[model samples]
Target: MTTHCDFGASLNDYLRDRLVSGIRSESAKQKLLSEASLTFEQATKIVLSMEQAEKSAAALSIGRPERIHQMSSVVARRGRFDNGAQHSKTHSQTARSDNAGAAWRGAGGTAKV
Candidate 1:
């Protein structure tokens, strides 16, 4: 209706009413309707705010678990790496101790401290 015709003085009211009625969200519609007087600009602002809030909520709901999963996987990998490092360190110490023992035995147990 706005494309082909002009409402002149009633244009703002008509646009505001049309926007309030055309929205799919019942909560937004109710909020808009509760207002005694609302302009088209006000309605658009309310709708945009509501839409952004909903999008934010949806992104958090979907993204939070994935972020947790990624963090957990990183922790798991770090744990495995730490365990492997510990094992390698123990093996290296054992090999050094064994070499020292061999050196002592090769000296007929008379190696100086």
Candidate 2:
């Protein structure tokens, strides 16, 4: 059997250290280093997931207020807040066509249409 010379650190440990050093975020680097016997696979998964979440967050922040208003309007039109049940067919039709009639009715004004 042939024996190899012993390095101070195992290859996996060396690779893990290098991976931690390459991370741009100081907190992320610390998080990886804090793990007990962290494996390269685990570090890669954590970093990748963090990156994906950051991208999603950035995308959402671009039109956040407008997106929220649109979502709320859709939910209201779908009668989601009406006792958790959909509006009757007639009301649903009117709401789908023009929400102005529903708004007028709610404001104590009769819609001629």
Candidate 3:
């Protein structure tokens, strides 16, 4: 499971460092940081958006526009107002294997149940 804060802080550091060292642009870094500082969660969201944008950019650069679009659609669908995607299982399937009914003892393919 990924946390918004963990990856967000990492990304924030990354983009800031890259822009500062690689481009030597204080204005750009300040602008980005300021824009993302409007709310408490804005920074994390901006970081996540930048990460995803870079991923899509890489995919397009590699000539896989369809894959980027497909992945985007999946994200959009998952972002919709629903939690219907779930792991399916029956009641019996939920039992712990160690505590369940015993299996047949077999010397070969044939065995007594």
Candidate 4:
């Protein structure tokens, strides 16, 4: 059978309501527990969490991204890349025979493999 229908409420709200109804069923509870490797208590929590996450996703998707940006602060970092610059090494950090003084270099030692 084929069917098409739209909910009067948001998609997330509809999904959440459906999840609540399914979670109330014994078969749904057992399936959730076995499939998800969860206890009855955990199944209930997981169902509720999925419902809430869908609701939040729907809320975010339906709203304009720009308006949401104004509601929160976002910080980003960008580094300056200098093609011609050479990094100076400190005098005391020269490579040592014992490999103790050098931090970043691979110890030129034999591998068992």
Quick one: best TM-score, which candidate?
1
In model 2, the clashing pairs are none
Q: What C-alpha lDDT does candidate 2 achieve relative to the native structure?
A: 0.78
Model 4 whole-model lDDT (C-alpha atoms) = 0.54
lDDT of 1 by residue, 77-97 (tens): 888446445443588788988
Which ranges of candidate 4 are over 4 A from the true structure?
1-37, 64-113
C-alpha lDDT of residue 111 in model 1 = 54
Q: Which stretches of candidate 3 lie over 4 Å from their true place?
A: 1-28, 63-113
lDDT of 4 by residue, 1-113 (tens): 11256644455455544554567556455556456434445555777776687789888788678766754433212224534568776655544433453433444454222
- Tens digits of per-residue lDDT for model 3 on 6-57? 6765665665555444533454445455673344355446556666777898
Minimal lDDT window, size 10, model 4:
71-80
Q: What is the C-alpha RMSD of each candidate to the true structure, in Å?
A: 14.7, 13.6, 18.5, 13.4
Give the runs in model 1 whose Cα sits over 4 Å from its true position.
Answer: 1-6, 63-113
- In order, the Cα lDDT scores of the candidates are 0.83, 0.78, 0.56, 0.54
Clash tally, candidates in order:
0, 0, 0, 0
TM-scores of the candidates are: 0.51, 0.46, 0.28, 0.28
